[model samples]
Each structure stands twice: as C-alpha cells, then as structure tokens.
Target: MTDSADSRASLGDGIRFAFGTLTVLPVRVARWDRAAARAGMLWAPLAGLVVGLFAAAVGGALALLDAGPLLAAVASAAVPAALTRGLHLDGLADTADGLGSGKPADDALRIMKQSDIGPFGVITVLFVLLAQIAALYELYGESWAQGALAAALSAVTARLALTLASRTGVPAARPGGLGAAVAQTVGMRTALTVAALVVAACAAAGTLFGASPVPSAAGAAHCALAAVAALAAAELLLRHCARRFGGVTGDVFGAVAETAATATLIALAVR
Candidate 1:
C-alpha cells in the first residue's frame, strides 16, 4: 500500500483499538503494529481523561440522589470497569494469584493463565477495589472537581507507570500478546516523552488546583498520593512478578495499573 494509504489504515486500527478498550468490543490490536506507536501511547492518558471524567460525573449524579460517600465512590468505579470491562481488574487478579503461588516461573505463568480464580486473586481484587472506593468516597465530600481531578490523576499516572514499566527489562511472557506489543512499540523515546508529559501535567495540577481541592488537605493528599502511589505500587508489583515469574504478561500490566490506582487512592484516604 502507498504511505498515505498505510497511514489511513493505521489510523483506523488505532481508533478501533482505543474504542475496543473503552467499550465492550472484542477488537484487539497490538500496540506496535500501529503506524503511530509513539503518538498512540498518548492514548493512555486520554483513556484516563475519559474514564476519570465519567467517574466524577457518576459520583456527582449520585450525590444528587442523596447517596453516601460509599455509594458515590462505588459509582465512581463503575464507569472505569464498564469502559474497560474490568480488563485491568482481571489482570490484577491473575497477577496476584500467579505470584501468590510461590512456584517456579513456568508454573506461576501457567497458574495465572487459568480461567479459575484462586483465593489470593479473589482477596486481592476485593481489597484493592474496596480501598479505591473508600478513598474516592472520602474525596466525594463537596468538591466534584477534586474528585474528578483525583480520578483523572489516578488513571493517567497508572498509564504512565505502564509506560515506565515498558522501559524496564520485563520481557513478555509470551510471543504474541499485549505485553509483547507494548514492549516492542514503546521505546526509550516514547517512554521518556510520556514521562516528561506526566511530570508537566502534575506540576500544572498542583499549582493550579492544590489548595482548593476537595476535603481540603485530605482530598488533595489523596489525589497526590494516588498519583505517586500508582507509580510506586506498580514498581513493587512488577518487581515481585519478575522475581516470581521471570517476565510480565499483558495481564500483569493491566493488573499493575489497576492495583496501583487502587493503592494510591486508598493511601490517600488513610493518610
């Protein structure tokens, strides 16, 4: 195909991939094959923007229903899961189950791929989601904007963590999967660019919205904590996974992103 034709085809594929992730579609386009991997990676933050905004809107609407913080927080979570159909949540469970096995790399990978959920996986998913809901509930007190910003920060930072993990030596567990695709598509340059963008965004956020953020200190803290916690939690999870399984699967990446976001929000609540 001509270059122009290839560009158009690539664009179509990327749109499909993003749409598939955000909706209940079976479309699965690998990240690398896109003609604009670098630009496409930007989709990560964009997903956060969409998901975060939807979550905040849900909470706001629920507030009008006289829902408590818990209910509002629960509402906040529904949008993300619906958008991605719990894809990352599944990854989190699988990774937790696989790593909890304490078996050899091959064995762990095998267990992770199983359709049946293990005890560890079940508990991990529950606690993580609970933490996120609880923290978001705390942020739901008065400032929808703060809650929305926190959610947005969580989503974007979680994706940024994914971008960060791409630079590490975590090879794909399989030959053909999202892990392999992202690893191949996201190079040093792409990762670095994302990093710079994230930093800039955070700086701008803190300067612009730090003082009036919801729950006052507590709410702002959660938002900031969620962002940092997302990165830290993902790093720890990836390290543990690497040590246990020798490599990361696409599921692990999603799992890590979800887990990190949950942990970040939870930490903010408790702090």
Candidate 2:
C-alpha cells in the first residue's frame, strides 16, 4: 500500500492539477498545452459556480438589507470580472478595434497585439459589460441554483465554442500563439465531452428547481437556444478567422469564446 505521506502528496498534486495549476500534470494525460487551454474554456463554468454562489448570497443579503436589487445586480458580474481578471474583456476590446480598424488584415492583427487601447476597443468593452450587467440583473431574482447553473453553463458553452475555434477552418497566425499548440492538442472527444455535460446540466436544472411550469419550460428552452447559438456563433467566427488569419490563435479563441458566452447568455436571458 502507498504510505500515508505519499497518498497525501498525491492528493495535493491532484488538487493543484484541477484547480489553478493546469500545467503541472503529465502531457500524456491530456497533453499539457491542450489541457491548459481547455481549462481556459472548460473551467469558466466552475469559475461561474464560485462566482454565482457569491452573487446569490449577495442578492440574498441585499434582499435582507433592503438595499434594493441593483447593488447585488452589479455584484454578480463582479465575481466573473474578478475571476478572469478581465482576460476575455481584453480580447473583446482588441477584437473590436482590430475588426473596426479598416486597416489591412495584417495591420489589424498587429494592432490587436500591441499593448494599447483605442477608442473602439474601450467602447466595446464597456458596452459589453453593460449588456452583461443588465442581463444578470434580470436573472438575479431567479433561484440561486438556477443563477449558478446559468453562470457555469454559460462559461462551458463558451469553451465549447473554443473547440470549434481550433478545429474549424481558422488557420493559426503563426507557429506559436495560443492557437497553434491547442490546435494540435484539442480534439473532437474533448469537445464532445463538454457538449454532453452542458446538455446534462440544462436538463437537470429544469427538473430540479424550476419555479413554475412556464418558467421551467422557458429556462429549458433558453439553455437549448443558448447552446445552439453559441455553437453557431463559434462556427461562424472560426470560418472568419480561418479566412482572415489563415488560422486561429489563442487570442482569437479567447475572443470567440467570450463573444459566444456573452451572446448566448444575453440571448437566453432577454428572450
């Protein structure tokens, strides 16, 4: 039998591998580069779970304190914004500026890489955040579990899009960026695993804590629609990126995944 100390060490390594240290695991287990990148896509929902729980508590606290719902409203977004350190938000900005620059495609790509923000990029990030805040504010009143489900699945759906980003037409910009290594590592099986889990979550949420028949039905519909839309959006983007850069890159994956999640959540919440 393994010694107690060895067992404990194994546990610690497993925790680090799952939690924040994605690169520590063996490359053969899932491939170091792909595993880390997939973590970028897959773990959003896990991040959402943590953030959603906090948001749910914040909303409940607001209800108790009689501060009104809006404060808690913004607070929900605070968690995700903090978790990603606004990495996707940066992608959103760079993508917007690059697309809108009207410069040659190569110049636009270069601009996205430059560590500067432009008028378009700044506006893009703010407006995107504003839209997210509004959608989440509406969802604040929903059950904590439901809200949590939505947050986690939204992130997962975004990453599902990332699988498509790497696999579909997008050619990598260069040999190295975030895109190249992942393109080799990410595969159909990993993506399909994500897809299966997303579906399971949606079904389970509806069966478990749905408020009313109508709302439950609506929630189920929302999840289905969100998944379809996210996938479609990812596909469209990969096609564009393939044509534009001759291949996808890590930044492109970030941009596509963020856009898909935001759009999916907004679409589901609003209608």
Candidate 3:
C-alpha cells in the first residue's frame, strides 16, 4: 500500500481503538498494536468531545425545559457516567481503595483489582460526584452556555489527561490489560500537540458564549484556563499514582481522567 493508504488505515484503526476502549461507543477496535495505541491515545480527546457534547445537550435540554440548574447539573453529571458505563468512576473508586490501603505496591494493586468497593473507595467516589454536581450547578446558574461549555470542556479535558498519561515513559503497572496495551505508547511531543490543539479549539468555542466583546474574551480566557487547571490537577494525581503503584494501570488512567474532568468543572465554576 501507498504511504497515504497506510496513514488512512492507521487513522481508522486509531478511531476504532479510541472509541472502543475509551467509550461505550459501538466502534469495533480492529488493531491492538502499539501503532494503533499511539493513534488511539492521540485521538482520545475526540472521543471525549463526543461524550461532552452529549452531556451538554442533555443539560441544556433540562435547563430549557424549565428545570433548575441543580437538576440540569445532575443530568449533565450523569451523562458521562452513563456513556462510559461508569468505568471511569469505578476506576476512581478502585484507585482510592488502593491508595488508601497504603500497602505495598503488590497488595495495593491486588486491592485495586478486586471487584468490590471498600470504605475509602465509597467515600472518595461520593465526594468526587458531589464536587462535580456542585460545580455544574454553579455554572448552570450563570447561563446555559456557561454550563454547556463547562460540561463539554470537562469531558475533553478528562480524555486529554488519559492521552498525557499514556505518553512514552509512563510505565504500565502490570503485564496485561488496558494499561499495558496503551501505556507509554504516545510520544511526549504528540501528547503536547494534541493538548495544545484541544485548548485552542476550546478557547475559540468559548468566545461564542457571552454577548459583549469583553465577556466573550473573558469566556475564551476562562475556557483556556480551565483546560490548564484540569491538566495540572490530573498530572498531580498521575504522578502520585505512578509513584504509589510503581507505574500506571487501567485504574490510574480512569482516576486521572475523572480528576481532570472534576477539576475542569470546578475551575469553570469559579467566578
């Protein structure tokens, strides 16, 4: 095949891998090679964008139907969980349990692998969800556009965190499963490029939010800042998990994603 043809095939496989693994979308992954994993991590934000749009739509619809910001926030918060089949939340919970255990790396990994949620897991998940809902409520109260932008921004930010976590040099915690399949697959340069693009696009989108030019410019700045904050927060969690677990795992990826999403919402909620 020509180089162009190879590129097209690789791109297609990347989309499949991204949507198939990162989401509960119907896309069937056709390749599990490092090439595909690299492309998939690079494209993860696109999957997040789709999920964010769905969440925004649902929240906006609720607000339009005379539902209050609280309900709109609740609905928006639920959409990502529903779309991803709660996998990320479960990961956050498991990661909490592992970290809370404070055991050796092996024991912590074992705790994370267990299906049941422990006390620490339960409390952490509860607080995270509450924080997300509270942030969404504040944004929704400002305006429908504000709320919607936050919803979308957060989702994209979440996946962008995963992309960063998968970059080369981040080791996998185990020899098998999703972590091993994608860990250290993306280059640092590629991850940074994708992140910069996402932030630029989000800033452009935010400029459409407010009526006056000043507000619009502020909106753009806020959007950009929110992305930066989300990444910063997720990075902290990623580093902690890597050190604690001796490397990244599927649980770590999920935890990173949720942390980023929550941080985005919280940042946007601030006046």
Query: Which of the numbered candidates is closest to the native, going by highest TM-score?
Result: 3
Candidate 2 structure quality by residue, lDDT tens digits, 4-111? 222222333333333342122232332234445444444434444454455456655664565554565566556555655666677767777777788877888888
Residue by residue across 1-271, what tens digits does model 1's lDDT show?
1223324336546555554554454656564453443334445666566666777678767766677667877888777888788888888888888888988888888888898889999998898888787778887664555555566667667666776666535667776677766553455565667767675665456443445433344444444555666678788888777666767777788887887677656654554
lDDT (CA) for every model shown?
0.67, 0.59, 0.90
Q: lDDT winner among the candidates?
A: 3
How many clashes in candidate 3? 0
How far does residue 187 in candidate 1 sit from its true spot (Å)?
2.1
1 or 2, greater by lDDT: 1
lDDT of 3 by residue, 183-259 (tens): 88877777899999999988988796666655488878888998999999999999999999999999889999999
Question: Which lDDT value does model 1 have at 18?
Answer: 50
Q: In model 1, what is the error at residue 172, expressed in angstroms?
A: 0.5
**TM-score order of candidates, top first:** 3, 1, 2
Cα RMSD of all models vs. native, in order, equals: 4.5, 6.9, 2.8
Stretches of candidate 1 off by over 4 Å are 1-16, 22-39, 206-226
Question: In terms of TM-score, which candidate is stronger, 2 or 3?
Answer: 3
lDDT of 1 at 224: 56
Q: What would the TM-scores of all predictions be?
A: 0.81, 0.74, 0.95
